[model samples]
Target: MQPWTDRTTPRPALAALLTDVVPANRRTLILGPHAPQLIESVLAHSSDVTILVRSVSDAQQLGEDFGPCLQVIAGALDGLQTPPYDVIIASDGLDRLLGYDSADLSWTARLDAVAALATPDAVVVLGLENEFSLLNLLDSRPPHERHGDDEWRPLHDDPTRPVSVDQFRTALPWQAEVYADFASRTYVRADVASAARPGELPTRLATAAVDQTDVPLLSPAHEGLDTAARAGLLASVPTGWLAIIGAQPTHDIYTESAHTVLTATQTPTGWHLTTTPATTSDTSDTASDTTGAAGELLVFDPGVVPSTISSGVSVESVLFRLAAAEDVPGFRKLAADLGDWVTDSRVVLRWDDVVYDGESFSHGVSGWVAQETVAKEDLLAAAWARFHGRLIGQHRRHPWPPWMVGDDLVSAWLGMSGVEAPEPTPATSPDTLPVASEQVAKGKQIAQTLDDLLGITNELADLRTVLAEAEAAKHELFEMKGHVYGLERTLGFRNKAMKTRENRIRELRGQLQKMTAAHDRIRDSRTYAVSRVIFHAAQVRKPKVVARKLVRKFRKR
Candidate 1:
């Protein structure tokens, strides 16, 4: 197989646009490389179709697919000469039509050559990729197409190439209608005024295109799209413009929803959109105010559900908006109503899953059912519980104090959601932590999720250290307690000895006092006084002195 270049891949939305624009049973010419699906779509309407390709292998493959119906020419556009046909399609811009053998042609020269191939009344279709596209700015990968091996002369280097939507329209020879193409082709096919109306279909479709882009961007494309919409510039942010020369396309905007591509045609009463059944769905579908009435956008299959033109702002978007604005009262009022709605409806837990245009609340496009039966109260609690983590983690600003976070904040959110929040468990540090505990959702995206897992791993490691420290501290405390008990026993024995010594000293003092009183009474008696005076007169005698000494010794005893 030849390496495909400048191939028009089958886009269902783009196909619908092609079918509506291209007429039946006409002579057609498709230049450069186009996907088999696109060729088949062209053949479905054309009588005699000719496909011109620079790849010889592709030409051979086409010959086999359509033996006689398709006339395949395998050469550069400059080499092959062709008569004018009723319709001409060059989906890939002028650059891809040039081959190795052909001389380098300016964009102006190439346009002139393509014009020469068409008849006076020929309907021409062309695709011009805008240089200032978000994809071009966001794409971080190395060269694949823009300045790759195939593109000898890069489209950017060409001074004559059209840059903007207006420039692209002016570049076309005929008065062509230009459309801003994204994930779905032909989202903005009407005047700027009509597309830029209150309906958010263009913004949603554009942002959906951003989400579907398969490349890493500088920043989140969703955020960028939202910024663009708010600035009133979404109508002109084109990845590429599909310009049609002869035929004016019938429809205004073609957008895709849950399972189907919907055509939004404005009517007298209001706009008509498709709807799906109110069942539990998994993926969250992005919605617009123009959705078949704020929350009532989804339907089973092809059916035009009429919706009035009103401010059908999604409750989810509104809540987020309120949170961003730090409007606690506004957020509370809406969140309470949302909780009530979720409680009543066949529940999809996300706030974004429901829509409210101020008057009533209904289901938005995307939905899913719970795996096991869950109470509506639990659904409301768990969703906000999850959102609570996102609020703090995403650094969402709120009027609540800094201390009120995590579970405390979750309780507050649940209260606002109109559910009586469960009372908080009082805080206490556990003596020991288990090696592992079940982990619930933390509202972390991929990068932060990796960090969170790393953080958990680090905490687990830290927990091991903590356990070791605690074990050591416990042993030390046990030893200290034993030492204190021993000290108390020793103090008791010392106290008992001191009390015994005090009692003996008190008894000895009482005996001394009684002896002193008896001696005083004897000295005061009259007979004792006379004997004392006689003993004093005979004090010189040795025998009396000896007796006196004996008496004194007896009294001391």
Candidate 2:
């Protein structure tokens, strides 16, 4: 790997633009064919770096192990537990990402899959061959004649025939759009130059062009630069452009191999960009002002704005709209439940006159009335009696008069009953004695003869006493209830009258105060007006009299 240096004048300018654009210490993901020299140049300037490389063997050979990153998929992205990576470089990885039949991944599906793996704020850059470029046209030669690693190298071995750029363009519009939308800076093929200067050409092509191989490029973030001499001018750029340095003979525009570099600059409107040649091998620093600072570029891509456009329409709104358009029975029922209905007097009048009178009065007047109305009334009375029986059934289920077993029958009839668990019975006391005498024996015999009779007599007496007590209690309760009702009515009436009186008093007091204040104001105004008038009249008389007296005195003198 080589550090970035300026061998040509334009090289320094290009280096400066890149340096200004790339962020210092930020990681950049690079994709596509090898550009090791370019990688060296970028690393020389950037402060910190990480790289994701596709050439697993090369990664392993460099003593770098992927651990579980490439393999253990818990689901699709299982092995990602490897430390968080900063940059991912895929040289010739797009075909794989797009699911070349070998791997069977579609571009759209792969894009979606990778997006799920990436940070929401992560910057994603895709680089593809500019199918429209002049070099891409030249690289379509037969396999043996073409560059050893040409895109279709494995397909054909014909040494003489070459495929034109136009033929390739016909098959690849999908790849074009992918590159355009994602690439911040797209590289069009540039003519190859000889040395480190402008417009110079190499004298001759090597006899074994296939044998002459370029250095295997470092990963996209380019952390392999150790020396300054091999560093390309393109490497002078600062980090964060996600530099896509594509300079493969497979795309063949140059007699000598050189690459193109794209550096994206962030702007409020969109990404501003700088593109540069990736071939200069000069290591000495020419212009400090031209190169970007170590830490200046932004690594995160904010992605598309409004998100709706890039992601397409949302399903939630469409579903909601469809639901709104549907006249669901659920909504109808809800509306009915919420609505209010009122039966009017007009409806009652119509029912009574039209249905009731018309059926009865049309027949012989008295007979019709007697037969239709009276019979209907009798029928209604029978129905009412049946309805009242249900009320009686309620009473039977739970007798109304309270029972002594601690049960409230009225509450039971009302269905407001509750059960109280019985208390445990106390053990019978043992300390007791029995007494007997001649009189006791006579009493026992008397009780034996009168047992059932005494019970009947006692029951009758109890019933009478209960009835009388109940009547007296009812009368007392009625009187008390009446007293309470009268008290409530009297209190309510007094409260209302008192409030009215208080309001009237307040109004009268307000009026009296206003009248007194007005009377005082009127008296003061009248007195002041009269005083002013008298004073003015006195002044006028004095002025006239004084003038006449002065004149008379002067005449006498």
Candidate 3:
């Protein structure tokens, strides 16, 4: 029973046992580092399966692969409700790796809590490796020669020097014991296999069929198979089989063409199909049909991707890029397949630091290609740098930039810009300061200036009226002065008339003395009296009326 080589073979056995013995319509809770694979297999057998992951990120990945069909819970088992699953299987990821004694119930209590969540009579399954048993299978290396036993150590710490299963087990003592104890019943046993050679079985377990082969989960340099052979094996895995491949030494595994091919295509059920002959140009409908509509989910280790972390670059980064490259046609097919599944689907892609999406003008890809290839750039890095610079500049300008923009105001600002602003709340709001009010104030000032101008115009109009009145008064004064001069001339004429009357009186006196005529003297007296009366009337008369009357009187005189 070379379990590692025949990873898919156990599924049929497990499926048969489940469908034949266990009742249908049962809900299963799968807990493991690689629980997705088991869940995928179980889903094929049963639809009512709920997967619980330890981390939020894991849940997201599961959702992406399963298309929201799977319900994921993030809390640990200790906090979960009872009877949550009909059958529960905790895969390679258990607290066992954390160095607790195998006999302790702490790890078991966690499992019990998980099992309690299952339906009554539900069987609890745990996937684990026997460390002590496996250590016996190493290439007879001394105990001191083995690497450290820290569970967090990189999978590829000794890539060039592949450690045998027994050596690895010896290095990690508590890990194997924990695995052995957690299972209600064990199906895949690592005891004999870990102690045996790659192709051989242990004499003690050889007679019994419960055996396994020593195959490196990752690339092993000393292993007979090279990278290409391993890749071929990975690609050729049977349908309904999902593989979670991680890189050694924290290197990326999705980069190489082999990894790319694996990530690009998905297995539907079995690996029996012979390799098709390469065509100069694949024009067939099936060949061109790139839809990965039906296949197992392939999850690549994102930690190996340098773009995801701030750590140094590793070979694993290459793996992700390669997978992305090979997935062009496959992913497009998947998108089409999912068309009927979702009312709306959005894919946001960021390469260096530049972000793009399916909604963008270019449909996520910024640069163009040869109509077949996708150009990959280190855009995520660039975008991150630019974003940091902008943030720093903003911080320098504002001590509390976030606080400056209240939650509601930020939303309003975003709304003004025609973007979907979040609701105005503490959690959803941004903390930028308000400046639009200042603009409004400036506008008010402009209006006030206009009003002042209007008032000035009214004052100018009033001054114009006053100037006209002053000019009229000046003209009336000039007319009054001319009247005074006319009156002075009339006075002079009256004085001359009086002098003439005196002379006439003198002449009358002379005539009276010379002629001694009573009749002439009486006539002169009458004339003098009449002339005096006429002069007095002329002096009392109005200007025009008096002048006209004086002319008539003079004519009579």
Candidate 4:
């Protein structure tokens, strides 16, 4: 029995790749769970095909759906006893090929087993999911896929398996074409090599891929993908890699967009570029289809022979880099050039879609045209307006003040672009010219904003904590000052009391000195002696009376 009944994941890029690699009437083997549309596409290419799915129920549905045209095996890879196939399609990878009764096999072991069932000269298109894909790294959800061992047994830490593109190339000594398969798009090496030589079609497709996704990504995928592209790691960091063994690659780069599976070609045909569609049935239209409605998207400009190469890095990407780096002067110069490019004719263009080499602006590979006539000044304002929203909304730092709102910055940018600035709009709606509404409100952009806000909230909480501490210290200081004032008053009162007591003691000492001087003068005088003698005679006549009188006199004194 299988772990899950239906484990099919739809990959349009992989499917588009299949249509190119899988030709007509070739014995092909699809040896894992894949989208039904992909399987049908393979079957349509070749009637002699074998599909091995682990789920019995899925196999039953497939058998009922396709009838006897396909050989559907509802069993493990080890159990299947079929001859080697010419073309083996395992774009779904081999991890899902595990079952209850199957032995614990490493990634390389399974690949070896699958390789054993392929002929020496067979074309094997195998997929390897990148654990380090930007989307995978930016996901904020729980990693149940890593821990869900009960359902699918993942081979962990297999040194024999390739973890990166270089390692994969090293592992496969044969000629193999590797594609960086994001779900919506895939880039070929030639297209990704050099924008000046081939073109920046890969980056253009990457930007489209970023815009089309509606998932809850942690940050803007465009920024990450752009940065990856600049760092020369875009192909190395896709959702997965498709290694086509024993055959050459098909095109420069192709994207399975919402509209069609478009392919870009860079042939020097009188300097006009052209791009073709992968398959007539799968693609809605070719990239070079110029017959689009007046206001609708165009596949590509039919004039450029190599739609993949461009003048230089996109004007839009450079402008964003300038803004992000806080390079206002550089941004203003570039903006002026962009403004010059957007006369009345090119007013509906987006900067991200255009590349500015060093000097001038080129009508880039953006597929849209202005629905109605737009003013030159209004287009400049619209461009700056979009930048303003993304700048502040994404919490990106700028040379301008944080208090400055969108209208302020937008007006400033317009002035820098040498255009007549408009009246300031106070409200901060996330809308920009092309994607203005999504500047603040888009799920991916808002998720980045949310992640930044969470960090800001923590910072604000820390500030509040410091303020609380300061308030407590302020209370302590106030109490200390009051205590000091009370001590000063008490000391003043004690000093005043001590001065009064000192004055009283000095007066008593002065009186004691004068009395002693008077007594001394009386003793020195003769009259004093006569009076003393008379008192002595009276005391002698009545000694007891005299003594009593003397005692009374002493008591009175």
Candidate 5:
């Protein structure tokens, strides 16, 4: 039989949880029959791993394919009689076991069964589809179908049956680390935590490391937002949820690409969350001293007050100051707060980096600090303009407000920079005013000329449309003419065949006439008359005379 799951790659969320939360050496128990990639990932890390499938055939097939390294059990969760495992992964199959008919009892029994299979401190990873994703609101089809998985069969037909984040927590009755799966339910992109909390800031950046193949699950309209912002939005209305139960709290989270590292380190003074640069090294050039040099770090200040660290300050001092904060929880929260502040303040920072040409260069950092208060309307106008510009870049025909061009756009830009639009000055002298009026009249004449030109262009476009239609009709007529010509050729061939047949009939009639003449000649011959006269004389003779003639004839024979 074919594989039960269509997935070739392990779900991103599941992979993240496995790499970050579950220990490599732990004896793992995979409760559900998952994708092959997921099974391989679990088996690679854990020596004592068992997969619980629904049927004995599935177990036997998996065992034959994976060999004896993996133990496959064929039974229900409650029926399985095995030792408690250190980690239990239930990425799929749990939802089906927990039937949609009775959600409460199903969840309760499912959780109990799961708890029984796991050790007291085992890490339980549960994945569930979130019905309230933004894409669901925009589209009528199921999320799986929209993602190109048309054959995916859901346990419940009703969209409302799927558990929400709140419902999931209530059912589990545990403090679980919740993560939002973007692009699809299988890929976890960001952790869902209070945006107000500083500890969750790394998750925002961690989203940047998500595989680029996973794209705008919500819609193309959201493509304008950066990865971090998009991740936050996904966390708000996630496509799916990955709940890591009985897992330890994490202080730092690195993006999958490992380009950015967000660390929450505790100093002697206070707890500080810092986002720093993570560098990759090339060891091919051993002679070069700067071969493994790290990239420059840009630490955003989370405090309300602008950073005092100047460009003249030493890089070490700046790093030290960034490492010492009063009450930040995580890198993600700090980043989010800073982002929000930047949006509100309309303070933009532009940076340029200079790479060293030789091994003599050392790692250095530069800093910029600014604070500004902009009006709400001005900020809104500025944001709208920027967003509109981005939309124009993304789409071929972006919808723009009719009145928001020329002077309006300029005014918005000025207002966004916290500057008022200058008013027009009045003309003071009467002589200058008359000249200005004459200039206005000329401008009106020019506008009229432009209007006439526009009308002529429209008429030309219409004529082009008509000419294109006429050309199409002419081509069609030529095709029809070709078809008629072919038909005439076929008729000619048929006429030739009929003529040949008529000649054949005439030749046969001539042969028949010759045969009739030969038959008449054979009937009129003198030998046929002599044979008829002899037969008539024998029939008229008496029986006695005929008997005597027959005796004489017999004697002669």
Candidate 6:
């Protein structure tokens, strides 16, 4: 109502329903303001398309986008005055239109309003959420709250007012074909009659989750529910249910998907059961002329009765009932009445030597029967061997660490077997053993030999330890020897330097002696005496001249 802007891409289930049920030339009326993309897709096939919206704003937006080409009604479904439509698609909007909190409006009244707008022969498709879905079981919150719809208001103050499958079915004017939708209700799988049949429900519901790209919508705790469903559990509980109103039931049983089809048709002899792959041309063929070569068919006797197996019935009980029927006519009659008991009753049995000629088989039996035929002794022996083999295989695959061998391994093996393990025995010393008189001499000899061997072993270990220490000491000595060689080279360099200094000193001393000798020789020579006298005379003459000149000058003055 607040200008619905969340345009979810049209789910595949809705798309498939639209394509399968809606005609290209028929006038289609969409009861809710759906995604724009969905509207565009509808326009490609049908020329006359009208969408009903709750708000004027939504109508205005749609009108602006499509102009006059598409008609947008700006009112609720109850107030709309529109011509009868050939196809009407309401994607779970009826509940909202009726108002969840509106106590005055009944579902019947709301359905009547929708019926008024649809032609008598119109194909009406309605999508509704199952109140008893797996998602609801895990969470008590309403869908609007879970989906984070801030504007959502409960129809009533009570939280348990959601529309259920039974309520939805009762509101419908005609019988409808219901399907379970998965992947947030995007993909739909047929809710076949096998689901209604006892043992067959598991097979019918055992289909894989609808192919989806989104992460599964199931809680982690409920994750295994799908596998259980495939194994023939949860046939009654589906995520959601999609009801196709105005469609006639053609097949005796519906399959989860179009690909797997089961059909039962009446013939002159009896009812013929046939399983076939759905052909693109004809999807609703319950009976085909082909033999077992193309598809297998089982002919049932006309007097056979059909009975529903309770979900609580066990396989053993059913087998017991089957065996009892071998002699009792009444039991046989009852078993005959049980339609598809083997498949629908959820009884799992392994079969041996099973063959199919597209009709019946030869020497086919359940695995339980084969197991029963094996002798108890042989079975026990085989089981024991298998257990050991499994243990050996585990050991080979992931052997225990060295520390876990012997005691730890034995303890683990005992624990796995649910046995209380005893304490491990402590090793005994040789001295603790008692010696008898007769064997004392022999025992002493043996003891002496063992002691000697042990002493030798201890000595060998000590020798090895000494050898390791010696190796380390030898390495240190080698390092010391290298250090000593380096010191020697340094000392030799210093001695060479000292010798050169001594040689230089000797040369200097020799030179000094020669110079002194030369000096003495020159001083004692006649030439040296003459030269010295000349030098002294020059010196005395210069000063006497100066004195004479000074005396002559002073006298003149």
Q: What TM-score goes with each of the models?
A: 0.63, 0.24, 0.26, 0.65, 0.42, 0.40
For candidate 1, what is the TM-score? 0.63
**On residues 1-557, what C-alpha lDDT tens digit does candidate 1 reach at each position?**
15544434445556556777888998999987766766777889999999988877778889999889899988887876878888988866676787877888877788888899888888888877677776666555555544555444454478888877777777778888877776443366735413442225455556655555555454445555666667665645657777888888766666545434555555553344543321112112322222333233122222322343332544545766788888988888877776666653333354433446677865443333332345566566556654555455334466778777655566567677766744345445675322111011221122132222112122222233355567979998999899988988898988888888788778888888888898888889998899998888677567777889999999999
lDDT of each: 0.61, 0.29, 0.33, 0.63, 0.46, 0.46
TM-score of 5: 0.42
Best by lDDT: 4
**Candidate 2 positional error at 152, Å:** 7.7
Q: Rank the candidates by TM-score, best first.
A: 4, 1, 5, 6, 3, 2
The 10-residue segment of model 6 with minimum total lDDT is 344-353
Against the hidden true structure, what lDDT does model 3 obtain? 0.33
Question: Where does model 4 exceed 4 Å of error?
Answer: 145-155, 190-204, 207-231, 265-311, 324-326, 345-348, 369-378, 422-557
Rank the models by lDDT, top first: 4, 1, 5, 6, 3, 2
Question: After superposing candidate 5, which stretches have Cα over 4 Å from the reference?
Answer: 1-8, 35-37, 54-65, 74-79, 96-105, 142-152, 155-162, 184-192, 196-236, 249-389, 393-557
Comparison by TM-score, 3 against 4, better one: 4
After best superposition, candidate 2 residue 430: deviation in angstroms? 99
Model 2 clashing-pair count: 21
Give the Cα RMSD of candidate 6.
30.3
Model 1: which ten-residue window has the lowest total lDDT?
Answer: 435-444
Off by over 4 Å in 6: 1-7, 98-104, 140-144, 150-167, 184-190, 193-236, 248-557
lDDT of 3 at 543: 80
Q: Report the number of the highest-TM-score candidate.
A: 4
Best of the two (3, 5) by TM-score: 5
- Give the clash total for candidate 1: 8
